[model samples]
Target: MSTQQTISKHLDKSVIWLFVIVFLISASVFAYRYKNYKTCEDVAFTVKAKEFRVGELIKFTDNTDQAANWEWDFGDSTDVKTNKEVLHIFNKEGEYKVRLLVNNICQDEKTVTIKEKLFIIDSTKLPVFNVKSSIVVGETLNVEDKTNNASTWEWRFGETTRVNSVEKRASYVYKTPGLKTISLVVNGDVKHTTTKQINVLPIEKKEERISEITGTNRRLGDGIKARPLGYEDKDKEKTKDEPSDKPKVVPFIGDSQFISKLELVSNNKLDANAFKEYFCGDINKNIIVNGKNTSFLIFCEKIKNKKLRIKDITIYREKGSNCINTVTISQNKILGIF
Candidate 1:
């Protein structure tokens, strides 16, 4: 009874243990396979950028698993891109909705804006002066000027003087003056003129001027034809043709021009003669006076170190003719008189 019963019990136990081991191995293998297999819902899609300029190109990407296919919508009216990375252009300036679908189940959406950035003109030239305001009975008349970006200048001081200056300064003499008009032209383009009223008083009643007459080392006032007729040291002299240490007399000459002697006294008195000498038929070369040039009348005054006041400027077709027109000037306006 002991041997038979023991063998039968051992066999039964072995069979039950084998069945349990096989069942456990099969269950473990099935669980591992289920964990690795991915569905369309498990994949994720993304866009690399969220902002772009107007008319700029953009790209979309997918980082999803089991995403063998992709579809894109750029919100603009255009065809879609089926690749993982698709190129798109934003043509308009506004916010746009971007959508990407991966494997027909995974999806991502983004919003971006395209924009354009916001652009004034400025032009005006400097002012030129033609004449001064007043002169004393015995005061000297010196004309000068200051300007920029000008290539030429013309100055005219009524019938007493006409000057052409390449420098910024020139001069004229008015021995007697009631009223005169002074004019200036720049770059052969712009023209400016003013009329002044010179009230001549007695020599004793005039006031002395604050400045004195001196030679100029630099070029004379504004753009004109004449080179500087001033002075400088021997070593600091300018070119050979340029006038150095020499003074030119301001002459008034023309068929209708009158030459007058003018002087400024120490007491600020302006002494001027009213249309004294005749400048009729005086043939000359490049005759420049009062900023105007002709063949007979020449301006010879060097106003580097002098100051003169102008009263009125009258233009006539001929000498001793009636005043046809007049120009008025302001008190605050600055002038260069030689």
Candidate 2:
């Protein structure tokens, strides 16, 4: 054979082997991808929930084969999680679309409806008793139970000679006058007990009351008095000698007068000196205005521009001393009147 012909034959053989190898590799890759695609298409999952109420927990389970990873979306604007089995809780009552993704490629979804739970027991409605705290002796006392979810009731009338009853409502009469304790108990899975006191008073008699009144009058006559008996002339002389420190009676001002004063101040008809006299403190350039210590001129300037009226004024006096302590004035448009 010629050298050129031999070299061409070898080159042709190498090209054929390379083509076969390439075909084999392509076929293997195609087969692998086809298997994975079929597995993804056949992916399935199930959602299990014991209850569909708010605050209930739900479980998600992936039931597909050939899955390497899992992801879940609870559809409640929450963060997505990656797990084969996931547990989630809904905070509100609404319909939520739950989804499960297998191998990050195949997915399935289901809608869950969460509703609000009803028939919840309130703590305030627990077993309780209601009865009058004071009753006169010889009068019948009636008591009622305000208990809830109780199957039976027990009541104790707190009398030595009285008998207890299992009825919800009970009545008892006492012949004595004093403090008495009443108790109640409700029978159920959990027993509840409550106790109260009643003050039983004795009926008053007119003859015994008249003697008591005379005795009280005698005790009052024995106490100290402002003036001695038959000393009215001397007491009048002493009163003339000493001047009283009592505050003189001032005529009550109506709401109209207060409104007129406010209007005059706002219209510049009333000066600051006159306005300051209405307050209890010393008139100066600065005073507390609206809880803040500020210049009196600024305070007056603010009110002068606004239409204002005094709503109310309360004057407080020091106890025993009877001297005026402070005056609180409430205005319709302005604050901080001390």
Relative to the true structure, candidate 1 reaches a TM of 0.25
lDDT of 1: 0.49
Q: Rate the local accuracy (lDDT) of all candidates.
A: 0.49, 0.63
Count of backbone clashes, every candidate in sequence = 72, 0
* Best by the TM-score measure: 2
Please, what are the lDDT tens digits per residue for candidate 2 over residues 60-139? 78888877788888888899999888888898776888888887778888898886542344446455877787888899
| Residue-by-residue lDDT tens digits, candidate 1, 1-338 | 79999999999999999999999999999899677555676555555544565556666677776777788888887788899777777766667888887766677787866653110011234335545567654576666655567667676554444343445576655554344445555565332322233343335555888697886576656456554677455764546657656432333443222222222321223222222232221212123334443222122232212343334333333323332221121111112211
Q: Considering summed lDDT, which 10 consecutive residues are worst modelled in model 2?
A: 277-286
Best by lDDT: 2
